[model samples]
Target: MRLSRPLRALVVVDGTDLHHDLLGASSALRDIVLEGGVVADRAVGADRFVDPLPVTAEADVYVLYRSSTHLAPEQQAALSAAVAAGKGLVVLHSSNLFGFEEGGIDADQVAYELVGSRYVSHGDAGSEGTYTVRVRGGHPVTAHMADFVIEDEYYVIECRDDVTVLADRTTPEGGTQPIVYVREHGEGRVVYVALGHDMRAWGSPHFRQVVRQAVLWAGGVGLDAVASWSTRFPLGNGRFIGPDGGAPA
Candidate 1:
């Protein structure tokens, strides 16, 4: 089964919108080509999960949405192990929604240890309205034009010392917070983007690119594959080795 393609992916969402997208019509068609993993949910989990929340090793890539970032010990161990074994992760909306500090559980313990960030307080970002998404680097995904605007929510996340931020927004109070971040824990890579609270924001070309880029990059695919794969695996946090080549699955 593995040889038929290469990688398996699961996109998990823990809110309403994310679930709608993952289980929608567009996503099924998209999965035909890319063929990875998927677990995009739009619900709120009262507690962390212990097993593979999305699927299993069958999925090498994960696209998380609107769920708590903290993982149950079992869940964290599984995901971390997958990545350490060479899996990929792509997060949207609230990979940071975890409230482990407030509600302690097995998953909370795993999450607290994994994320290492504690939530202290939250204040309004004061709605910057629709702003431009600028690429800080020359990655092909975002190299298209320059910057594009989208109606998005700028969240205030409490972070840890080891958190590596990719891009951030200027807070009204004169501080910067990362809207997108990627970190390597053990062997797996965590790519989290704080966008998608506003559904309309997905309209921007750059917005889609950011998501597509993060997904493909995590699974180790390239830009040229985006257009084709986008259609083939719309509902995914899905994966396919593409024409290139990923792990042996």
Candidate 2:
């Protein structure tokens, strides 16, 4: 369905110490939202660390892609409250590594609960390899998605059973692991994607499709709405173009 107005998304990508290309990932995320016909505003580094509470209130959906900076308890509570109050949340990749601490002290349990999963491990050292993302039928986010291959960290996560699994991958140990899922929090929606390790995943058309659909779905856009809009205006090449038909700033 075509929205009467564009949804506002606040994309946050910051970490004290990160091994992944967070800045590049953040740019890709912003582009995905924009191409999906949503308005995106990014918060990076120190800008995100300052007064995180107020920022949550301004956007309809919050997209997070951070690896290592810990949020304060109150900050975590604010995020949980925001989602509970009907704001959407899209968590990507290493953002699941939120609550763990070396000695289990000062863990951000609220954030972990909000995400509905925690990163357990990626298996072994050379585990980062090519794998297929198998789409499970019957979800708006994976409506017309096809299984695609990507080279990334095979994330092993401990997830809540309540979340609906939309897509998954097979582990080397002959097991299945969820690569994408969704859940509801109060009046809001939450989506978690285990891909996007780097450009390898980001460059995939299937990955872009999932992220775009996830953002729209989380923002309360129904399947029919998205299908209608996408049919009329396909996101060609997944590039962000301004209203004037030129590249955006």
Candidate 3:
């Protein structure tokens, strides 16, 4: 039988550095991707997970929104195992700071490897500059998204060679920085978006849409399939309706 719900996603805001509201960000993600149920969790520090990262009943997608410089070795291992088992991994803004610390790669190497991007730094903390983000190509996640201007922290990331570039933002210094990307890992997928700095991004329709599509794509669902389904259902509300013409539980 087909599953009633689209898929399960776990949002982890383990270590935010208190730069952003972890709860609020998680809630925003939940609202953005309601088609796939989401459960938000946090970790007190590098060693303590409030929700105790699931092992057996792992969700289809795991979102790392933490800003911590480190994660417990066990926690890192658990995430690695999940991805190896073919579960999707989503890395958000500050999560890129998980490694490449002050001295060297002194943090969660597993997460860094999975995400394929390292957070070098950002311009500023306040709403000073506007970032003109552009979609790189016709990828499933960026299929329906267009160039958008957002007032948020513009990140400078050190990206990998093999990752597929999904979006980019050109800095004022005449350098282009990747804002979004995706790549395959083991038997799973990985997505990284460097836009979410605070509520400004979370509240934007464009950001929300990109996040929604990324979640579905990470979970191994295609936006084309979702778009086709939405067209047939004609909800007017951007939501999912099972072929039976009822919302999935």
**Candidate topping lDDT:** 2
Consecutive 10-residue window with the lowest summed lDDT within model 3:
229-238
Per-model CA lDDT versus the true structure: 0.51, 0.77, 0.68
Q: Which pairs of residues have clashing backbones in candidate 2?
A: 1-225, 1-226
Kindly give the number of clashing pairs for every candidate. 38, 2, 0
| Candidate scoring better on lDDT of 1 and 2 | 2
- What range of 10 consecutive residues in model 2 has the weakest lDDT sum? 240-249
TM-score of 2: 0.86
RMSD of 2: 5.7
Tens-digit per-residue lDDT, 14-92, candidate 2: 6753588877888888987886788888887424433655654678998888877466666677778878989899999
Clashes of 3: 0
Ranking by lDDT: 2, 3, 1
Better of 2 and 3 by lDDT: 2
- Candidate 3 lDDT, tens digit per residue, 123-238? 54433478688776467777645577887787888887879988898777787889889998888889899888778888766676667667777888765564543221122454
Writing each residue's lDDT as its tens digit, candidate 1 over 98-172 gives 555446544455554454443333446564355545446544333332444567765677766676666666666
